[model samples]
Target: MRLLPVGTTLFVVLTLGACSPSAPEVPVGADGRTDPVLVQGRDLYQANCVQCHGSGGGGGRGPQLNGGTVAASYPDTAAQIELVTNGKGAMPAFGGRLEPAEIEAVVRYTREVLAENG
Candidate 1:
């Protein structure tokens, strides 16, 4: 059996860890270009939502939105939109910081993209 040197094994492990995959990317448009709204949504989600909701919407400090949870919870998109616009309990409101359209984009991203993944 061949044994790797300690430093070499450590280097390999570190490299592999660095190469670990991130969450799946949002799908592209029929034109082969990424949807602008989804792109904006993803950026907003990473900046605002990732802290509480896991990158994949698997939930951390926040409730899980993945695996169709968001859809099930708020069958009416407007309800979710309202919740995001108006702060609820521990969840801080984004309405003051973000434009209504931007809020809508993020909501769409969560329901359509992140929710589908986990």
Candidate 2:
């Protein structure tokens, strides 16, 4: 019998661990039906914002957006729209990349879903 190298063994273990089954899915809303707006928002956030804000908007390369942080910063929906559209500080401007409606949807998702979750 031949022994596997340490690096190869570690890689195999890690790969197998990653292939393990994921946790069960939970209903998104009280009635077990997710809101369309939230669904849209979630999709948009995942596509455009997840890289910086994290999967749950808990923050990563970007500032924390959960737990009323967004609400406190941008009290008005319009203000939130501006921030997300125009961007600020280290954040990149998305105004040109996304349409107005898309921006609104993402903001709604951030405020309604992400904030509420926190």
Candidate 3:
């Protein structure tokens, strides 16, 4: 049998791992149904946030929301909600435009879905 060098084997394993499928782009409920709140939040994010946060919250003009960045930045859910509602630095406040429920949904989406996928 042919044997791969240690470095080559490690590289192949790492490459395959990288190619593995990632978390679902959308969040689903325990019942296997899509979460309506997440759906609404995703729609709102696409409309309002994608321009800056980028698709899947990968980051662009705005700081990255994925990869646990949101969780790290705002360990407290309420703090994150407040930031979304009030805005900070270059981020514009959504409280004036979005309903309270919508704001909450979007925040949930970022923390639960985007954070995981990233």
Compare the candidates by TM-score and give the number of the best one: 1
Model 1, span 16-94: residue lDDT tens: 9977534447798789988889889988898888889888888889998789999998999999999999979999999
Q: After superposing candidate 2 on the true structure, give the runs of residues whose Cα lies further than 4 Å from its correct spot.
A: 1-33
The parts of candidate 1 lying over 4 Å away from their true place are 1-23
- Per-candidate TM equals 0.79, 0.71, 0.76
TM-score of candidate 2 to 2 decimals: 0.71
lDDT comparing candidate 1 with the true structure: 0.87
The residue-by-residue lDDT of candidate 3 on 39-58, one tens digit each, is 88888887788888877688
lDDT of each: 0.87, 0.79, 0.85
Number of colliding residue pairs in each model: 0, 0, 0
lDDT (10s digit) by residue, model 2, range 1-118: 9999999999999999977532112237888787776677777888888788877678889988888899999889999899888989999888999898888888888888788654
Better of 1 and 3 by TM-score: 1
lDDT of 3 at 41: 84
Best of the two (2, 3) by TM-score:
3
Candidate 2 backbone collisions, by pair: none
